[model samples]
Target: MTTTRKPGERAGLTPEIVFAAARELLAEVGIEAMSMRGVAKRLGVAPNALYAHVVSKQDLVDHLLDDVLSAVDTQVATQDPSSALQALMVDTYDVLLLHAALLPAFLVRQGARGDNARRLGDGVKTHLESASVPAERVDQAVHVLIIHTIGFAAFASHPNIDSNGYEQPPAVLRRDFTVGLKWLIFGMLDC
Candidate 1:
């Protein structure tokens, strides 16, 4: 399905461009509705042209997610272990909320294949260990923190929640997230 590129249209076509377009499309239409053709159309390129950068739709999604995760600042890991972990959770929640449209896809594809995800996981595990969490429980603790952050972002961003008459204001949601995260951290430390 390859076609001759129109002058000036595909001149600057690159993986970065493709990824940015895909991310925008994902945010606008969601994972289920996003398509290579749609992204290509968004970029003013032929659908097959995207294959030069992304092998398939799944690859595009993976790249998009990795890009988003890479934006998270995990430097809080350098601070006191427990406080660092709490900070990381709060930061992660904010990042996920910023890309709330992608949370559902991210939660389902929990496999940490991307470099950013691996680095974030490593930081969390290291912090947990530094906090003196049992070696056997480090993995569980990390999973709990990650799942809780993603779950809250996903639930909060759902459209039907407002129509269902259970909507909480953003301030209240943030307060609840902080309270719940604190409790989770306390429980992990107590164990």
Candidate 2:
């Protein structure tokens, strides 16, 4: 049986589906090798079909980055500013480590203007403000936190090419991140 999709007809394809496929493809081949055509091929659709949902490869990557950023747990589990900030930052670090493929995109986008990005920013800013971080230094603090989280995740995700036997396992890397995150939060909050 040979059923065919009409030209310009996407069948069941949706933006969500496209983004999902892109995420999977990125996870498999990384951002460098990921392409609109590659994503379309994965979905078994013509490459042109993706344009109906995404304008370009950059647009798709932007969406994917924002989509992943939405997963950051922003809830303040405790009223204590230091503890809340630590929790938020740890959650953010974990998310970045988990989706390391999007790290480059974050660097390019820089706290992307997407709604999810706005929400995450607002959440962090609220915590910082609550902690009485000086208004003049809040933005700088945010940038430092973003850089630290992304930078560390990128470093941790890189393959251990050291022939001199310097390798940190996942557990060690995670512990290091937690320790670093604690230092950043406490220093920023001065708590």
Candidate 3:
């Protein structure tokens, strides 16, 4: 027998719950195959029930990106602008690594149009300005940093294995990212 929800009756459904279910669904099936019906199946609800909270699949994906990015720490830890910028980038990398499945979404969406994303961008600009990066070059610097961070995280998320299938250790991956970030930061600041 099929059960239907009455009008205006949520049955404990909320945007948060929907987002959680959608994220789980994405993790299982990946972005290309994730759909409203798939999310509804995961949540034990009708597909139309999801529309009550999420407008469409793209909307759900956008919101998921923002939700994942909200965990990034945008705070500057040191007075030295370069160090502070590196810290922020490392934090971003860590957060993205944790939600590695969503990294492709970032590539397709060109980053989220949400508060958290704006905050991160603003933090990057603030650090660059503090480091005396020329105003005209700040945007370019920001792009370079973002591209590096995201690209590195996406590449590192996969198993870095040898011909014998021996995967590289996690510490090596992190060290490589930080070292590269440090070099990139110094290069941007010196110019």
- Estimate, for each residue in 134-157, the C-alpha lDDT of model 1 and write its tens digit: 999999999999888888877767
Off by over 4 Å in 2: 1-9, 107-113, 159-164
Return the TM-score for each candidate structure. Answer: 0.84, 0.84, 0.89
Question: Among all windows of ten consecutive residues in candidate 2, which has the lowest summed lDDT?
Answer: 3-12
Tens digits of lDDT, candidate 3, 104-179: 8888886776788889999999999999999999999998998888888887888898678799887888898999
The predicted structure with the larger lDDT, 1 or 3, is 3
TM-score (C-alpha, index-matched) for candidate 1: 0.84
lDDT of 3 at 61: 95
Q: What's the true lDDT of residue 6 in model 2?
A: 44
Candidate 2 vs candidate 3, lDDT winner:
3
Q: Model 3: clashing residue pairs?
A: none
Tell me the spans in candidate 3 whose CA falls farther than 4 Å from its real position.
1-11, 162-166
Candidate 1 lDDT: 0.82
Give me candidate 3's TM-score against the actual structure: 0.89
State the lDDT at 159 in candidate 3. 85
